[model samples]
Target: MRRLSTLFAFTLIVLGSCSPSVKILGSWTSPSMSTTGYEDIFVTALTENILARQTVEQDLDNLLNEKGVNAQSSFNILPPGFKTSGVDKNEVLQKIKALGSDAILTVAVLDQTNETRYVPGTTMYSPMGYGYYGRFWGYYSYYNPVMYDPGYYTTDKNYYLEANLYDAETEELVWSSQSETTNPASIETFSKTFSETIVSQLIKDGLIIKE
Candidate 1:
């Protein structure tokens, strides 16, 4: 009984040490932002990598729409050269207004950094078999030696990202957030998970309603 409890406690410690895929570092909301929440929203992601940008915008747009938030991806409306060639800002805003979007959400990757961390090794005990663990004397005789795991150093990549929400009508900033994602597996995975994280937070902040 005591051994089982110790094992269970160790399991909890390992689980608690795990890190989330996406973590919000900080957030802010404008005092003048609407209290009723936004309905039609435009989503965009800023990145030199066109594929990454498109994936993020599309994933986030789909997530919001699934929640009945009426979201649109900027990639669908913006020209192919809009990002690469740097189109006129005035013209882009004019086009967005025609889409009937009441709010705009833009995500930008500010920086990517490599972080080195040392994971300390832990000791584990393995029983011979279930039958062997039946009696205390049997278990004591069959008790495995303390297996010491060697510690190792690993490098993780962290992407610093920022999100900004703007009221379309007034063209003023509303909600802003900064977050970090550690060691994203792939562009698709990052987009999907990060989109979920952002939507969940926006709902919590009362900036958007799931509806």
Candidate 2:
């Protein structure tokens, strides 16, 4: 009996170490971005759009890593451009049935924006003769140097992503998390920093991670 007790205690410790504090598994759908009023600007800044998606995916991976979760065992990210609208619960279930995962995470991007500066200016030049005369007279030209003007431009937008965790077999949403943010520049440097910021917030707010 004493030997059995020791073995059981050891098994418990091993299980505790191996198990993810939060058991989320199955296929995860990438968040969808909303196409809204800033269509024109969004098209113009295509790079930012791509970066935003990449950042979100990376952030999710990072979160799983931090939690000591085996990424492959816990989740599989769905391919890009996979539409969730008409996909029924059964369909999701069928696809993940083989995995026998614990849950499914669905992410959606509600809104996003990218902004850049548009500075306008022109160079000033004097006629050759005028400059020659000024130089000859040891006097500067009366013409004023052109000044460049930079205007503050922003593409203010809101983004929403809904994460739905479903049972692997039943495919029912058991847990969900939605996130929103404004003016996320989408530049690599800023996007990564902001992505981490937002993910941390989500984990905090959802009580997914201990503070």
Candidate 3:
């Protein structure tokens, strides 16, 4: 019974430690936009992985379209493996502008880190039980302290991603957010969740309306 209890406790601790988290480290919204929600948006994902980039941008474009926003994916405008070469950036910008997109949304991976550290286990002492004469000798009562083994160290991996919204007309950044995820399960899941979060935050900041 004691062994079973210990195993259960350890399982709970391990499960509790395996949590994925995401947060907006910082953001900036343009002062020019008086209302929420952009009427038209051009979505782009800058990732070395072509498939992942296309998936993310398409997901974002779909989400924005669901919110009644006109969104165009850069994948549709730019050919496969599109990179600055013979084509001028100004020309690409002009093409996007011609699509009637006032804002351009860019999502990219900023950094990733993996490290190992010593995670010391905690030592707890059991309380003394009271007997009939315990109260009388309370001040002088003594008990042996029980110590547990120190916890083993574990390695962890983290990923950081950034999303930015630029005003196409003014060529200025309208809003941006940075997010960190610990041990992301998969690229597809992370991209979808991150895209939803970014759009929701943009709405909350009144950068775009739900209309």
* Residue runs of model 1 more than 4 Å from their true location after superposition: 1-20, 83-88, 122-148
**Tens-digit per-residue lDDT, 1-211, candidate 1:** 0122322322222233224389899899899989999998999775445666677788898999998898888876764455535667777787788898999998876666667999999988765656867888777767656588999998776666789999998889999998877776667777787899899889989899778
TM-score of each: 0.75, 0.41, 0.71
lDDT of each: 0.76, 0.38, 0.72
Best by lDDT: 1
Prediction 3 TM-score vs. true: 0.71
Give me the overall lDDT of model 3.
0.72
Best candidate according to TM-score:
1
Clashes of 1: 0
| Model 2 score (lDDT) | 0.38
Model 1, global lDDT: 0.76
Question: Which regions in candidate 2 have their CA more than 4 angstroms from the true location?
Answer: 1-54, 72-77, 81-97, 111-155, 187-211
TM-score of candidate 2 versus the correct structure, residues matched by position: 0.41
lDDT of 3 by residue, 60-160 (tens): 88898898888898876787667688988888999999999999888766665667889888877766665625565553353335567788978766566
Model 3 regions lying over 4 Å from their true place = 1-19, 34-36, 117-150
The digit string of per-residue lDDT tens for model 2 on 22-74 reads 21222232242221100010000111233444544555555555654322222
Q: By summed lDDT, which 10 consecutive residues of candidate 2 come out lowest?
A: 37-46
Clashing pairs in 1: none
